[model samples]
Target: MSKEIKEKELIIIGGGPAGLTAAIYATRAKLNMLLLEDQILGGQVRNSYTIENYPGFKKVSGSELADLMQQQAEELGAEIDEFDMVERVDFSGDVKIVETNNYIYKTDTVIISTGATPRKLPIPNEEKFSGKGIHYCAVCDGAMYDGKIIGVVGGGNSALEEALFLTKFASKVYMIRRYDYFKGEKATIEEVMNHPKIEVLFNKDLVNVEGNNFMEKAIIKDSIDGTEEEMPMDAVFGFIGTEPKTDHFKGQIDLTDGKYIKTDESMRTNVKGVFAAGDVREKEFRQITTAVADGTIAALQAEKVIVERKKNQK
Candidate 1:
């Protein structure tokens, strides 16, 4: 059974850096705000091992940073509800409505910061060995493969960073990429190329994954030579890319071909009173700093929308 409908001045749909930042700003602006997170409060950041880019902290664990953000938001009077999965959203009326598993939320403004999720490699036995052996987060599973061999896929910054991190535990790491050249920053690329524990394999695609109870090996195809080889490894870490969690907003908001929400510079979506931020929105850059900036802009804009709406009613 569904719970009673609750009303608020603002509701943030995610609990990551973006949503938490939004909550902090919204509460400081004196807006009645509620944050909903279905899973862990940290979102994807929790899967991260270390974050050195976020200013103010020389080096902080992703989980620690997330906990700090949540703490600050709560201390500042932001109401956060974890494990509340949103069932649906309605933006047809003047007040945006969000229906979750337990409650229906009616809000003057809504900020969609439900960030992107890891894009899985569409290989045979991939889903079967998700937790068994095929892991997406190196931080969460890297220790399990101590003194073992593992394959790290993708040529992006995240993939490179995670592979480097895995080297601390894994005996040897195979860094695989579908492209000939690394797409990450020059410095990171150089580090990965020079790392003694890492072997860089370019123009390779993961075609199949095989395992018994857990992942044992993966099949890779050489795009350049059309040759196939079996890479023996304990586990494979896929960091190919990510897809935005915007399926719930279909027909409710404008989106790009990649399914990212379309928003203006103010982070306002096409739908009035609705805004998008973080990795969920279409933008060139996707980083913790960018997500925080998006949240701040969205919350301040949402404050404006709420104040204007109240004035209209008066």
Candidate 2:
């Protein structure tokens, strides 16, 4: 005899702003929902020390915001499962199966809100000095380099953005780029170039990071020629790019560029009854506010699907 299959109105993967917001909306719509998070509920926002740009709150700690969102979601009757890593997703059948390390969750509708991860620099000692002197998120560890010289690797918008933000504490900021031309927007590039505290290095690649316990210096090679040089610094920041976390749903859904999921305006993926939101979806902006908006839209769409499916059966 076959085991009885459990089913839910909606299942959301991830517990960040996107996922929590979805739960809030879906629960309010009277949809039975289950939210699963690999670690804590907060995603990248939990790593941030301070968040000043989020609306309503002029200034707030990342942890505080996450706590408030989680509380609100729970109050709305959404079930949250933390520290559950999803191993696979089966969306081919009418009832989706989400397998985690501990249990299997079945749902008629699914929403994926997994966010992105920091990109690393491809250089020697880069991995070795990760905690020592190398860093990726300036917002998380910028305070430690107060009044000290720091090097930022990359030539994109995020790289320049972090360098500009780091200038508040760092004595001097070195912006290193492998190409002479930066790919960031004109405004960001111009602002960083004109900043007196920022020194832009063109056609330079990080060869290695040298230091013990703490970062002391960085080895850079001229991309055009074979000339190499060493630059003294207290810390190194890498912002080359970001990679979306969508590995578990490899063949279950359609992906854009094999990274982000392709979704319509309503956050509906190619597969019916399955949706995606946050940085995992293909979109122009990846901000917290935009991610929350994605969550709201996805949850509403999933709720509609659930209601219609039940109505059709009756």
Candidate 3:
């Protein structure tokens, strides 16, 4: 029911900006490499609308950027296998083994670039109404609610950013924060507070999402007084936070705070020949540019390891 595939010099898990960037660098280094992705090559970027901060592109669609990165990796001789979900990984041996649904791959070095997922709101009918009228990324689904009323949950930078972006489409935006104060950057808070289209509802928490087929209203409760209020809206967006997707690497590599994989300055994990990049790694800023930088550094370090090994063989 399974087959063993030939080993490669390097294998990159995940197909997002980090994984793709690593593949490009490894291919240029003449390291026979393969890239594995569970779904498409774009990763979370595909769920975004526009990316203006990635430098070299003033304004570009997220999907377009992902496609371009994929094309570049392919042109550089990186073999990409989409829809390949890795079941397990073995990094104890000299050759790392990556087991997927279709086949097993061996590699001299492995780079884990698996990213994080958005945190969900705990409320009734939340899962049932997902995509019906509720969303996680405002940039991705805000345009659909144009000229309508929408609610945004959380009080962080992402929440405020989403609220600001929603103003471009929604006639009115309601930001619900559980506490009296926000945890976002002061600048973002000031911008949101000054925005005419945005209204902040402090000391409130979402209790339920009400609708039959699409989101029609949200039930909010005052954290202090426990008073409930129903707000009618076309859609609800949540930007609470994100959790790393590092459960698979448990006990296999060192991690920080049981979330991000711990890596040295060179991006090498505690395990030799094993590296991590992107949001999965412990870093100060988790952004597209930083992810790309991590990938490049990991690939270059892997190349160095390969060169040293070849020399030892002689």
Candidate 4:
């Protein structure tokens, strides 16, 4: 005998803030919703040590905030399943089908909130030293390297911001940029440039990383003359950027030039009954507030679409 395919009114493809917020709305709206999370429910935010900008809470750890959201959604009757990797999704038919490693679900509407992941360099020893010495998420690892010298790669706003943040713990921070100029906002660039603990290295490329059991050095090549130099570093952080988690949905939905899901202001995708929110959507700003707003809009719109479809059937 085969396992029964579960049917739901709405299926959320992630369990981050956006997906959790959607669950809160969907369940309150009396929609039978199911949220699928491949890993921990907090997504990338789980790694963040402290978040100060989110309203209501002055400051809170990412894990704590996520737990609260998950608890609220569950109390409101949202069905959340974790560690279920979605292997395939089919939105071509009237009823969207999501196939996971364990089960298949037929859902009336699908909301994609699968967020992005950090993009790392393709250096020769980059992978080898990932956890051993190289690191990402300064919040998670900064405290471990107190008073140690660190190297930060990239010249964007995120890189600069993280470099500054690391200064609170690390004794020295080397800001490595491939171009001669910084690309971040003027204010941020100025602040980082004027910071006493940050040493800016322009026109440099991270060619290789080396360490015995842990990272101790990084090899950099000058972009202008290609002269190579080794920098003594305790740990290296990559704040380059992030890549959207839409590889599984490729060719199934329209995407923007950046490969993020193309959604309208209402969070509706080109395909009917399909919606996207959070960092996965192609939008100007991607923050916790924006992600929450996107989730609210997508859930309300999904409810409206379901009602309209029912009326048409009648």
Best by TM-score: 1
In candidate 4, stretches whose alpha carbon ends up further than 4 angstroms from where it belongs are 180-196
In candidate 3, list every pair of residues with a backbone clash. none
Query: For each predicted model, how many residue pairs clash, with residues at least 3 apart or on different chains?
Result: 0, 0, 0, 0
- What is the per-residue lDDT of model 4 for residues 1-314, given as tens digits with 9 covering 90 to 100? 46469988899999989999999999999998899999999777777666767899998888899899999999999999999899999999989999998888998899999999988876888888887768878878888889999999998867877888899998999998999998777977998999999999999988888889888898999999999999899888997878899988888999977899998899999899999999999988877889899999999999998888789889
Cα lDDT of candidate 2 equals 0.88
Q: Rank the candidates by TM-score, best first.
A: 1, 4, 3, 2
Reference-based lDDT, each prediction: 0.91, 0.88, 0.88, 0.89
- On residues 1-314, what C-alpha lDDT tens digit does candidate 3 reach at each position? 55868788898998889999999999999898888999878777776666767899998878899999999999888898989789988888888888998899988899999988888888878889999778998766888998999999998877887898899999999999999999877877999999999999999999998988898999999999999999998898988877888887888889888488999889999999999989889888887899999999999999998898789889
TM per candidate: 0.97, 0.85, 0.89, 0.90
**lDDT of predicted model 3:** 0.88
Tell how far residue 34 is off in model 3, in angstroms: 0.7
Q: lDDT tens digits, residues 190-222, model 1?
A: 999999999988898888888789888889999
Give per-residue lDDT, candidate 2, residue 36.
90
For this target, which candidate reaches the highest lDDT against the unseen true structure?
A: 1
Between candidates 1 and 4, name the one with more favorable lDDT: 1
Worst 10 residues of 4 by lDDT: 44-53
